[model samples]
Each structure stands twice: as structure tokens, then as C-alpha cells.
Target: METQDGAELCFPQLFNTSCKKPSSSTTQAIILYTVMSCVSLLIVALNLLVIISVSHFRRLHTPTNILLLSLAVSDCLVGILIWPGEVFMTTNCWFLGNLTCVIFMFVSIIIISSSVGNMVLISIDRYVAICDPLHYPTRITVSRVKLCVCMCWLCSIPYNSLILKENLTHPGRYNSCHGECVIVINPISGVVDLVLTFIFPITVIIVLYMRVFVVAVSQARAMRSHITGVTLQLSATQTTKKSELKAARTLGVLVVVFLISFCPYYIFSVAGDNSYTSSAGFFVFHMLFLNSCVNPVIYALFYPWFRKAVKLIVTAQILQRGSFEANIL
Candidate 1:
């Protein structure tokens, strides 16, 4: 108690109850804030570019890019809404009060759950396109994909509300002191969240991608082998096969990167509450958020249309007539 008494309180007026200000040095805080600020800004800007390119360009519109568009919007929201609030909570104290806290948690959960759902949808789309090419066209149309996206978000509302019901109903109920706003869940709830958000979705992604990888390798081998047939028909089949493989590879890279970033955060969750809120946990959460920034980079690397669109959008050429119909693909 005597040692703790020397520590500065976040809310000095709170007397014995306020949390002590974190013992990080001024230099460390500055550095941390700088890095986080840069990351937050990059996420917002990159995802904004994705949003504009997808929304503005008609030729780029496809079922798969539609899912990417949905994910980018959620990522943009993470930058705009989650980052500022997180910056405040981590650096300073929770001065925003209970209501804001409740809303923040609610929105965060919804967006995150919806993101996981979107990933699952993306994996399924890829799976069908690759493993079951014949049915993919009729099965995974624009209307159906859009419906799935909407349902994913709509379902998140009730699902997360139930998960966070206590926090919503009784804001600040889990805080240990005046300045803290941590959300605490029991082991049961933690397991439930893990199974729903991380366990099941990740399992589906990995399994589907693994299968896709094997089939892709075989298809690549087949592409190399000679096929004796009529010239025009053989060329068309080769073109179609090449297109499917490219789509699979691009989305495969995206999924791999996502899993690498996301696994740590949830792995820590399974480690218990202490680990979930620890400094290490905070770092993993940052890694999870890092996925948002990495996504547009992936698009830039793999998608030619994204690069062309970025070029046009940057020069404000997207505003010109017939720009939407430009041969971006």
C-alpha cells in the first residue's frame, strides 16, 4: 500500500479508488502513441481507398470483390471508431463514462463478429469456385452474396448483445476502479466467444484453404501437361482454368495473412482473463488490428484492378464520365 501510494492516480480526485496511471515512461508513451497513430491513420486511409474503388467502379463489381468491400468497410470502421476510443482507453483513463463504453463494446463486437462471418463467406465462395467450379456461378451470385453479407451483420446484433448483455445492461460493472473500463467475462462466456468467433471460423478457413491448395497444385501440374484438342476450345479451357486458379491464389494469400494476425488474440483469450487484458494481450490485439492495414496492401499486390482503380481515383479521374465503365479488369 505504501509503495502504491507513491504512484500517480489517473483521477487524483477519486482518492483511494482511482487506478494508478500506467508506469510507462514519457518517451515510451510518445513512441507508442506515434506508432499507433500512424497505424490508425494508415488503416483508415487504405480502407477508404478500398471503399471508394469498389463502390465507384462498376466493372470491378463481382461477388468476391463485394465481400472484400464489406470487409473493408468494417476495417475502416475499426480505424475510425475503434482506434480513437482504444487510444484514449489505453493511454489515458476512461473519462467517457458508462454509456459510451457500452456503445463502444457493442459496436466493436458486432463489427468483429461480422468480419469473421465475412471471412467464412469468402472462403466458401472460393471453395465453390475452385472445388466445385460448375455450380459456383449459379450458387454464388451477387444477390446471394449480398444477402449473406446482410444476414451476417444482422445476426451479429443479437449474438453479441447476448454475449455482452451484462456489460450493456450494467455499464462499468466490471471496472475495478474509477478510471478502468475493462469488460470481464466468465470462463463459460469466454469459451462460447472463442468457439463462435475464432474456433469454428478459423477451422473452416484452414480446412477449405488446405483443400484448395492441394487441388490448385494438381491443376497447376495439369496445366503444364500437353492437351491434344481443337485449338480454340483448348485455349478457352486453359483461360478459364487460369482465371479460377488466380482467384484462388489471391484470396488464399489474404486468408493466410488474416489467420496469422488473428490467431494470437484468440489464443490469448483461451489463456484466461488475465492473459486477455495483459500487455501481451494488448500487443496481440494490435496485431489483429494490423490485419486491416495489411489487407489493402494484399489487394495492391494481387489485384490489377485495384492498382488501376487507385491510379484513377488518386488523379480524380473517377469523377469523369464513363469512368465506371473503364477497362479496369
Candidate 2:
């Protein structure tokens, strides 16, 4: 009888202090694992492709693609580091101990917040490109963009370190039993996190994109109505305007999808973190993670350069010496 009972415990040796294995059925657990594993793998593969495509192609090293590449790196970590840990924790006991848990939380927070930072940079890039095209060349140079991305990441390290300091110092104080890992931010800290991670970044993104949308529409109408110059210089300028307009529309779609995916997760935080492991919570969390995977798909759908880059990457043509200078544009 004791042997049979022991089989159900997460840490059978420490019966009183240990959590029991979750009561989900074997088949159900298999299905959930299978599905989540696939999602995690797909996220890794897609984001890896984005990272490789942008990094390998010299022609794709524009300010805008630089931001996307930064975002892809953040998303790739989400796929590689965050989601797998989440999946393991959902159906299995925490076997890695408290230090690993603290590190996991710290890294997850950095990856997510930095992804939001990238989006804000992207919004600013689009805004400048559309509303102030004349100065964009100087204002949004590749060097400046690289500097911003670096600062965003460096700031994230300290910011998340501060937010997670309690967990790091105190370790697993919130866990009710062995075989479990939990991090608790009190109400005040939770409010601060919600504001910092969601409210401020999202506000900037929405406000900038709203301005971009207005400016892009007006510019598109102006381009349509005033098409007189057929000179080579004029033609190049017109083509540049058309390209900028299309890019704005594409990025606008990406931002909308990002908001939709992440809103539920933040809204849940606002409501209280009580439901974080509930069914609704699980769904929203997965949805938020899914945004990482969806970003590259958005690129594939809207950016022909991305499609061509992928072709070159997959066919191994990028291994050639002159591949970097290929006319991806």
C-alpha cells in the first residue's frame, strides 16, 4: 500500500514536504506535451531562420531589419529558454531546484522586456521613416540603431535584476512544498511590473504607430494624386516613397498582432496574479508566447526580401563568398 502511494508523490523520499504528481491522465499529458513541444520547436526554428537571414545578408542590414534582428534574438531565447521550462513545469515537477528557477525568471523577464523595447524602437523607426522622410537617413542610421539596441539590452539586465532581486536573494521562500518552484511579487511590486513591462512600452508603441498610420495614409494619397515627374531621379524618389508606405503597413499589422497576443496576459496581471496557473491563464500565457513565433511569419507574408533570404539560406547559397552582396532588396 505504501509503495503504491509513494508512486504518486513527486519526491517519494520526503513524503510530508513533497508535492504529488499532477493528476492529469497519461494520454492527456502526452497530448499536451506533444502540442506544446511542437509549438516550442516551431518557435525555435522560425526565429532561428529570421536571425540567420538578417545576420547573413549584408543587404538586409538596414536600420529596420536591425531592429527586427534584435527582436528575433529575443524571441529565439523565448523559444529556446523560456517556453521549454514553462512546458516542463506545467506537467512535471520542478527538478532543477531554486537557483535555476530564479535564473529562469530573471532571463525570461529580460527576454520579454527587451522584445517590447525592440517593438518600441521599430515603432519609432517607422514613424521617422513615414512622417519625416527627409531626415530619416541621418536620424535613423544603422550605427544609431545598433547603439539603441545595445542600451535597451544593457538596461534590461539591471532592470530585471532589480525586479527579481528578492527571488534571487531569498530564493524559494514562496514554495509550499519541495518539488515546486514559485516566485511571488507582492501587490506593490506586481503593480510596478505591470506598469513598467506593459503600460509604458505599449503606450509608446500605440502612440507612435497611430501617428505613423495617419502620416502614411496622407503620404499615400499625395503620392497617388501627384505623379508628374518621370525623370530617373524622380522615379527613384517615388519608388522609395512607395517602399516606405508598404513597410509602414506591414509593420502596423505586426504591431496589432503583438498587442492582441500580449493584452490578455497583462490584463490577467491587472486582475491579480491569482489566476496565473488557471486554464484562462495558461491559454493567455501560451498566446503571449505564440507572438514570438508569429513575428517571423508576419515578415514572410509581407516582406519579399525575407522570402528571398530564406530561399538563399535553405539552399545553402549563403555559404558562397559573394552571397552577402546579393540584391536581396
Best by lDDT: 2
Model 2 lDDT per residue over 1-329, tens place = 12355447778788778877777888999898898889888999999999998888888989999999998998888888888887777678888998998788778778878888888999999999998999999999999999999999999998877777788898787888887767776777788878888999999999999898888788777777767756788778889999998999999998899889888888987888732345676677688899999999999999999999989989999999999889988
Q: List clashing residue pairs in candidate 2.
A: none
Superposed on all Cα atoms, the candidates' RMSDs to the truth, in angstroms, are 2.1, 2.1
> What TM-score would every model get versus the actual structure?
0.94, 0.94
After TM-score superposition, what is the CA distance of residue 67 in candidate 1 from its true location, in Å? Answer: 0.6
Point out where model 1 deviates above 4 Å. 1-4, 25-27, 227-230, 274-276
Candidate 1, 77-194: lDDT as tens digits: 9898887677667777678887787788688768878888989999999888888888988999999999999999999999888887788888888787887767766677778989
Clashes of 2: 0
